[model samples]
Target: MGAADARLPVLEGGPLLRKAFPDHWSFLLGELALYSLLVLILTGVWLTLFFTPEMREVVYTGPYAPLRGVRMSAAFDSTLRISFDVRGGLLMRQAHHWAALVFVAAIGVHLLRIFFTGAFRRPRELNWVIGLTLFVVTLAEGFAGYSLPDDLLSGTGLRIAQGIMTSIPVVGTYVAFLVFGGAFPGHDIITRLYPVHILLLPGALIALLTVHLILVFHLKHTQWRGPGHTVRNAVGKPFFPQFTASSGGLSVAVAGVLVLLSALAQVNPVWNYGPYRPDLVSTGSQPDWYVGFLEGALRLVPAWETHVAGHTLMWNVLLPAVVLPALLFAVLYAYPFVEQRITGEWRDEQHFCDRPRERPVRTGLGVAGTVWYGVLLLAGGNDVIAQTFRISVNALTWVLRVALIVAPVLAFVVTRWLCRALTEAERHRLAEGVSTGEIRQNVTGGYESDHEPVTSFRPGAPRRQLTAARTGTPSRTPHEPEHPDR
Candidate 1:
């Protein structure tokens, strides 16, 4: 309506920005990812100003005395200079590392939220795909950035990466060459990965994140059924002031926490590890948590090798490093479609979020997956666990092997039963309001709870639609829609 608004037509859609957002705490998990990424980008830019992405070896002769004249990569030396010489360099580097760990962690938890709540059904399936893609790109970005320091631990990680790539049967070697920019520990690796870590992967991550947010805005936020909310409408605070304050405050808090942690916590101490050597490696070295699961899998798979016609197949490496992770992610990406097919329903997919208790099978699957990953994660530190507990390493490995198979199946069965019980409990509570501390006498003189039927007890307006997502319950209210979760 004004000249300024006319000049910037994008501002004309300001009223559209008034869209409501659910105040649910679980909804903030995605925001954690977004804010942590902002921190990572800002700190990463600061780090890149001094980082040298060359693999050339140079003798270290810096203020730190331990490795005063030892040979190390230029990448590592620049990393040392950035750590000791540049003001706030250590803080920024640590913050960047911590932020990356948090970023991937947020994505993982956010994905679990979406899956358990059935938010990836129907119209939001494409959004799920986009979110998953962003997740994957962020992992790549983290790995590239992690390896740029060229420490001993990172060198081991790269070696594992190279081996995984070179295990792809026919074209593995060529792919590895392309990725590493030649043979193992290629001289040009840091140079090649510099652009990818700083620009390419981050660029893709930003673009994909933009698309994910755009799609979310288009569909509006999904929410649980609350008081006065219907299948056609979502209930929550609007974005203009209240939710905006919450978002701003959350962003600041996330940044402050990262800063504090970076100040106090030491992560990825590359200087102590010395420079990466192809022939040298340290004992008891481990990667960051996100990569830990894969490492665990690599350790767990039995050492079974196959030889056929002079070609070798290392099942131990291929199964855990390559095939398992691929199949797992493939299943995750395809789950929405698979569920849709099983249910044979789609017309009412866009409205209210499904309560986890309302979806027993999905809840069970989520639990099973969590347990499976948890076992593998613990197995990743098998050597440490054995040493700490003073047990044989092989014995610990065998125990983990049994646990991996047994735990997930046990979790699946228990979760499904728990979900069903919770659903039944909710029904009983709805039929009879929560028990007050009062007792009443029945006709036979037996005492019982004096309870009143409470329709709903959650905050905000009561949900009008009693219809579940899978089945259409008869509507009592005049304006209620015929379909469930419409």
Candidate 2:
């Protein structure tokens, strides 16, 4: 070891091992995403060993009594076998699904943290684009895997996908043909998607994830603003013994949580849904949570079509699924540059994170975007909600449509006001010091609370330390005399 270290100086303990990362809880989000991906890969590899990706029609003779003798595709049959025949196979399948869900969710939340805190500025803009790309790729990967089961629910999802693809202007049919390998419910989809799900998309994810992490390390981790933290210096634990240990523990915790969820929760029960038949449709069917927004959008859009130059245009399918997601991702990709151009803060390199309250417009915009997404997600379940409440589905749809338009505006206004109010309150607190609970009589016979002078205050400091009082000084009115233990 000593000789190798001497021969390769890079192997020796140096600045890389001693690199400082902020000990903020929000920083753990990226680590959570990484760990979730690791769980996904491990469980996915296990499932792949027992699963066969085939579309040939076959009679199920599996141990599951309900599915026995049912005519189904080889893909669905293998899924049932995995669930019942192979020990611990169902657990791995559920874990893989849960891990994918968590992975997408973590990346989303991590991006929000970065955006709100202004961490995606200047030197980190490229990383922001890469992170957004990761999100898009992850969504695709998830949808691909979701459809591989060949069950009724997934087949319905694929049908919708095919319709969306066929809605494109001139090349729609060709694109659909290329993807499904012939037509809707073609024999080639499962076989084709198998490699993409397990190989192509995951490979792209790993490559992009590698580049993203390299950029993070090369650019240095962004730290919250505090006394010792600055553009030139980061104040936190070293990478080797401290951050490494904590991060390792966090990975274990994440894995344990996934396993626990897999054990407790049953997800994507293909037996219950039965095999996909193009003529039959399942009731109360919905896509995964990550794809819920698009589903919601499709449900909300009124059926409309136009004929231009003898070709029919499907505004309903085209707008909601294709155009909306495209615009959304485009805006996300261009936000950092657009913000820089708008604010004209072009030159400075920011390493210390900005407080959300300090930037009212950005905070408000972020909140508004979140509110918009939440509304869409809720809309995705309008059918279930309506049936449960015995309300008119049309009424609920109209309500959601109105909310989709007005709610975001209202959220923006309220969020901006609150941010401004918080900023002013913080400024006032810094200037006037904290109030003591003790009430004392003044010279005019009026009771008033005393103010305690804070000894130290800094942005991102602990709340307890923010109210710490100075030892020697007691703030009082000029008319009052100093008293000990009064």
Candidate 3:
């Protein structure tokens, strides 16, 4: 290594190996996303080998007795064959599906962590945009993959998608035609989506993921405020052995969890749903969890239309399906810039993470958005919920609609208030020090409790220590100063 480095001046590995990374659990969320994507790629390749994406009619003569001699699409037939005949094919398929779900979820949570902690400020804004783009691309990839089996549930989902596409004002029909190749349930959709799912989307994801990681390395990580930590210096484990070993173990653990889930939990049972029939609709048919918010939006919106100059405008479909998602993503993409503009903190780069309490408005906004999404997600399953609980679906819808508007406002106010309260409490703690749990008798028979001076208090140390103390192992003695250098 020394000889190679001496011969090739650019081959030096010391600086790269010595790079520091913060040791925090929240930082692992991004790693979870990356590792799950790896699992997805591996299992996707395995499933791709046995799967046929063609939509031509074929007889299901596989080992499954119930569907024997049933006429189905080649796509569905191949799916059955993979599930029943190919060794370990079912496991791979489930693992791929589970990994995809986990990948989307991990990216979402990682983005939330970034947002709430102010990690998306300043120099990291572009990376935030890239992260959002990754999320959007992954969603498209998932929907495409979900439809590849050409089963009844997927067919229903495609039907809704077709309706959504055709609801656009001027170009809706053309877009739908271009996507399905002619009309609804056209023969070419599966074949078309196959390449996109396997090739195009994955390629885009890999490229984006690579660039995201490069920026992370170049920009360095944001760290919490602590003793000996600063915007200019990162404090934690080095990349060579410490961070690398822990990260490798994490990757293995993610893979193992995915495998376990695949082995035990069945997902997307295409066989039960049967082949796609244009006229048939399955009961309680639902999309994957990530797609549920859109479904919920479609359900919650009222069916309203307008006629203008002999043209019909679909306010219901367009508002919920098209405009809502566009607005949501646009806000997400532009949030960092918007916040920078509002706070006038564009010139100085933020390397230290902000506590959620420190930025009450941002935290409240985050909570409000989350509540809105959660309500929509619940609304998506309104029918099932109504049926199970023996309630009126219309009534339930009305309640959710009201909540869709009111819940967010309430949540924002509550969250903002709580953040302020926590901030005030922290200030008091800083001023008075932590309670030492001891009382003494004064000379005049008055009783008072003694308090230890917090000589070495770090800005954010109290929150961390309080959290640790809740877990029953206080990191420091109450009698000792929280920090030796206040």
Candidate 4:
């Protein structure tokens, strides 16, 4: 209605609509994470409207008649009512859970892609740290989100968390009491953690994500391959029509899959387990799949006694809960610096993805992480293992203890060797074209094979200048252009 309004740049219809996108499947992982986040926000908003975050105990009169006489926290009761009473609430809750799982998973894969490719080399180092922080926050969010349910499984997870916190030598108990507002799952704990799960962490993650994107845009994307391979140096398309359109399609696809899985594959059937009872310990208690490694570590530790400075040491509890978490965080935070030191190189720019084999050390670490996580995951199932083998839990724990020490070393060594082999293979292929498995017979009947040719260009090259050609210029005669054919 106003001239100023008319002068404003048009939105929803822009030049970006005409942009082209790259058709690489690898780029879809980030889009999957973004789409999952979108779904999470939508579902979270719906759930917040129906559920109360209060910690006060209340009598339940929900559709689930079995819970009618039971007294539970308002948060837990509201969650159950939402799932059974409110139409579509269960679907939304499941979607939220699935989204959280996907978000954590995508970020892990994304970081791995960056690491193997040397994308985190220079300016992107900050982004790597941001990613790592996001991962930590996501795990915390998952823990809090599940704990809000106040079911036996969730309660057990909370107990483990509390124990881990209180395992610190000097200030552990105080921190635990502070965090939980008293003993494990104190009266106010849910009320305290609800905001952290639903609001604070989400808000912080969004802010960090925004910053991550801005930095990515400012720096442009890291790409693979040579310069002459494309008209441009970038790997993917612009973030306008092409990239955005493809991303939208992929997001829809991923969201659809998550929704389908959520609908069909249920998680955390808290109702069956009922409310948290300190006296009741459920058989086969397990944390979420993502946190299983930590749980496994706790299971693997041997019961031990030590004395230091007139203080009795409970090594089993302290090592898994306090020392382990500290070590994990420290290693993650120190990775960028460690890598920088190892490579002893600095650059203003880095690529987005690198071949994993090219970065042997990083690949080795990844393998080592996998092995470590795998061993711990097995440790978490120590009971099952003992039952299956008809062996003692103590013996199982001891075996895992030894594995915890040795498995990582073996993994790192094997991974490093595999990477070296792959690198050598790549070099061989680069030196001689990739093998097609066809043998050629030479003129004299000897067998020969064609190989890849070496690259003509160096690692980096300078631009060449263009000049005009002289018409009818006498070509330089062989050996005597300056001597005039003498």
Score candidate 2 by lDDT: 0.87
- In angstroms, the error of model 4 at 395 is 3.3
Off by over 4 Å in 3: 1-14, 434-449, 452-486
lDDT of 1 by residue, 1-486 (tens): 356556866657664446688899999999999999999999988888899898887999888899799899999999999899889999999999999999999999999999988889778999999998888888788889999999898999999999898777778899999987788998988899899998999989999999999888778888776455655665777775778899999999999999999999999988888889999886888888888999999999999898877778888888999999899989989999988777764554545677777778888989999999999999999999999999999999999999999999999999999888876776665566545568889999899986544553331113432332113342233343232221
Clashes of each: 6, 0, 1, 5
Q: In the order shown, what is each candidate's alpha-carbon RMSD?
A: 4.1, 6.7, 5.4, 8.5
Instruction: Specify the poorest-scoring 10-residue window by lDDT in model 1.
Output: 461-470
User: Which structure is stronger by TM-score: 1 or 4?
Assistant: 1
lDDT of each: 0.83, 0.87, 0.88, 0.72
Q: How do the candidates rank by TM-score, highest first?
A: 3, 2, 1, 4
State the displacement of the C-alpha of residue 443, model 2, in Å, after optimal TM-score superposition. 5.7
lDDT of each residue in 165-275, candidate 4, tens digit only: 766777888999998788876888888887898889999889889988777665556655432223234555766656776777887898899899889999777777777
TM-score per prediction, in order, is 0.91, 0.91, 0.91, 0.84
459 in model 2: Cα distance from truth in Å? 8.3
Candidate 3 local lDDT, residue 143:
98
**3 versus 4: better TM-score goes to:** 3
Clashing pairs in 2: none
**Global fold similarity of model 2 (TM-score):** 0.91
Off by over 4 Å in 2: 1-8, 11-14, 434-486
Candidate 1 regions exceeding 4 Å error are 1-14, 432-449, 452-486
Q: How do the candidates rank by lDDT, highest first?
A: 3, 2, 1, 4
Among all windows of ten consecutive residues in candidate 4, which has the lowest summed lDDT?
Answer: 461-470
